[model samples]
Target: MSSLHDRHRAVIPDWITLYYKDPLELTHGEGRHVWDAEGNRYLDFFGGILTTMTAHALPEVTKAIADQAARMIHSSTLYLNRPMVELAERIAALSGIPDARVFFTTSGTEANDTALLLATTYRRSNQILAMRNSYHGRSFSTVGITGNRAWSPTGLSPLQTLYVHGGVRTRGPYAQYTDERFVDACVADLEDLLGQTRAGVAALIAEPIQGVGGFTSPPDGLYAAFRRVLDRHGILWIADEVQTGWGRTGEHFWGWQAHGQAGPPDILTFAKGIGNGMSIGGVVARAEIMNCLDANSISTFGGSPVTMAAGLANLAYLLEHDLQGNARRVGGLLLERLRAVAAGVDAVREVRGRGLMIGIELTEPGTDRPAPDAASTALEAARSGGLLIGKGGGHNTTALRIAPPLSLTVAEAEEGAAILEQALGSI
Candidate 1:
């Protein structure tokens, strides 16, 4: 291991995992590529878990930060912050919720936590409904709602989170069912869960596409059907779009739009890509629910001017250049290419995802069981071939996740896919 990694392990918590057998310290990045501390160049397929929504070091975002920093950085929530307000206004308009109010946080965990806090308090219940394989965040509140055992460090929880069915499409009990039947089964299961559970369930929070649970997603319109059940009980719906928002999913600006038949969620949470690489997490809710909290609260680092400026410029670039369109066109190509490559590989279990968020699941040659070992081999091989990617799955981190910057070009997609093909071959 490198001396830096040794030093990191000595101080940093072991739970904060690093990638690859020998971790890479990325020193700089531009566009879809990054250079490691040792000066090895690699195609960055994960974009730091899709936080770099646009290309790395985009001049617009960099300059905006510089300009904002020159003026000021922090005024706290107590004072007037122009950039933060501007960003909140922009987000409120973009949020599908009517009469929506936005609250910024420092990370996705904080965003989801705030949503949970609002939900339970507004509804006056500590009960929550979460998908069986969903992952929300790493905080106490979020971990309680997260159903994936691998991610949740403890069984103790502040909220009585009820696990529901229907996030994973290919491995769950309802996997064999058709899309129509799958939706029906999941909806039926949800109804049963509600009937069997205690009264006053605050909300059914879900990720449109489960991020850390792999890039798995329920069938389209699945949530719409669930919404019908939730409505009958007056239960709210919260969409955790942390890793799936801002056109990363290509077809929809928000992942919830894939199930738009139910209308927008009562609360929508987002973070990863909105500020490019800057830390920007937030919750958008209708005025009724947001204003429900009686006590005062504030986030010291939530909407700092510097980060808000980065968010504004990054959002503008995403809109003006139609990065969503780029994600669609180039991501579609990459998906097709990966699928073709996976077809000939015996260890490949499935290839799935939308837009730039793709996952290649590895199994034991012919078996359907998760091959985390193979996943590790594939990761190392990919790195050897000068490609940096990511890993995630409920089944012990068995899926290789490829989510490049939304600004990825067709050429970069092809190149990354080619490298992935080689990596899979080696594994």
Candidate 2:
């Protein structure tokens, strides 16, 4: 093992997983590629788990951070922060909820935690409805709502969490049902669960596309159907858009837009790509829920000027370049190419996703069983071919995840796809 790898294993907790048999030490990146310490460059398909939304080493974001750092780095949430205010204004305007309020945090876990706090306080209950195969965050409360058994450790939780269905369409009991019928069944299941619960549920938190759950999703309007039920029961809906926000899906700016008929969610949580690698996370809620907490609270490192400036610049760059449109056009072509390549491969179970967020589920050759070994082999092979990808799934990490930077060019997509196809063949 390399000296650095041995040292990393000695210092970092084993639970903090690293990719590859030989853990890679990436020194820097530009555009859609990164170079390891050894000077080997690889096309980055995963984009640091979708955090590098725009591009690697984006000048706008870098300059923003540098400029802000040269001045005041932070004033905490105790004072009026200009950059924070500006960024919040942009987000509030974008949030569909009328009279929305924005709360910033350092990570998605904190954002979701704050959302849970607001929801539970507003409704006066700790009961929550969560989707099956969901992966929210790794906090005490967030993990309770995270339905993926692989991620959730210990069954104990502060709040009562009920796991719902319809997140994964092809592998569940309802896999054979038509889209409309599947949604109806999940909704009925939700209502039945509601009937069984004695206390009022605080909220229903879900990721539109299950990111760590192998990028799985129910039918387009499944959440909309759930929203209708939530309205009747006075339960709030929280969209965990950590991975699906910022037009990554191409069709919608926010993942909940796929369920637009039910209107905007009562609350929304975002992280990952918003700051383009700068640590930023937040919760957006209407006045009622946001104002529910009677006591004042503060996040010391929440809205640091440097991160806010980074977010502002990143948002501007994304909107100006219409990166969402690029994700659509380029991602569409990439998916088509990948699907064609997978057609002749038996180990590939499915190719599904939208825009830059795509997933390739692997199975034993000519069989439906999840082939995690195949996925691992393919990941190593992809890296060997100078491509970096990610793998995740509730079912033993059996899916190859391909989510490139939103600024991914057609040529880059083609290159990544070619490398991935060869990797699959090698597996």
Candidate 3:
């Protein structure tokens, strides 16, 4: 029989990439560790691309899923779904947006798609403002607005998207400016771009931190500054919190909170962590904007009972245990440890992030050029040392992404950091 990897390659799209030169099939997981097909245990630092919010095989989420499945697996949005309504109620109350309304989807892509539909319909325009070095989703509509050329496969788009500045703080044209000046420069650029665009631009959608673009983020209050300019033109602001939501950033519950001077965004999209490993995505917006559609829209599996239960239980566990505090405490130590490690390694360019979402950028020694090869080496080395991490960047995947479950312990963080240090040493 052919190997599972070979079988996968034969059936799956070639563009669907897998990690590692020699892939290892993960069989099961618990807490912050997972076992491979051969029963090799490894510390899971990436948390399945930051989707596992609390931990693998979390009892709360598992029981919720089981109990809900035994009752009713799914009921389309046409009927009154109690679980969906309950989850929505919790999310709305948590969301800072006034008169907030929620709509669920199966994945982040669909959530973002729904958000775009709402924004475009409410504003009556298809022109969108997106930040450079950003990755929203994989769907045609989301792809069109994505500014990262590496991920964007085509120029054809349903919406006319204009890329904005300030999503990336380290290597952009305004990188030399101080934090305050950087905000001023980016806001001025946004104003200038708005002047050049046609009237009635739909919305400006952005990630508080660019996840796929190697966890990059703008200076705090940058969006608040942009919000002032956007208000003048009546363009909506959509914060895509898919990867940075639910206290992943530690200092703030929502990534947009860092830019709270102008208040909550007009719209917000979230996914990845809320349901742990289960598929759950949603959009939250003000009532007027959410209810703007003249026609009806429903997601058959968007708010499925099982997924909602998982989300609710996962969210409860996250809050009740104060995983955000854990992320802040443990992540701070990990960040400091990694920085010290990077300081000793010449190929390591920079270590940046907050909470459990940290990134280690690799570059050619003594030069600013991205060293994707070095990143690959580090990845393999980490795996060999019984740890699993992820790699992503704007310049050909040159940064290592380290986002363990929010429940990550200090001892686990120390172990992961030590393995990462050894990996960097190998590179």
Off by over 4 Å in 1: none
Cα lDDT of model 2 by residue, 97-144, tens digit: 899999999899899999999999999999999998999999999999
- Arrange candidates, best lDDT first: 2, 3, 1
Q: Score residue 183 of candidate 3 by CA lDDT.
A: 89
Candidate 1 local lDDT, residue 37:
94
TM-score of candidate 3 to 2 decimals: 0.99
TM-score of each predicted structure versus truth: 0.99, 0.99, 0.99
**How much lDDT does each candidate structure score?**
0.92, 0.93, 0.93
lDDT (Cα, tens digit) per residue for candidate 3, span 281-370 = 999999999999999667899999999999999999999999989888998999999999899999987899999999988889888899
Pull out the clashing pairs in model 1: none
- How well does candidate 1 score on lDDT at residue 175? 87
Taking the tens digit of each residue's C-alpha lDDT, what string does model 1 give over 342-427?
99999998999999999898888778888998889999999999998898899543799999999998888888888999999998
Per-residue lDDT of 145 in model 2: 91
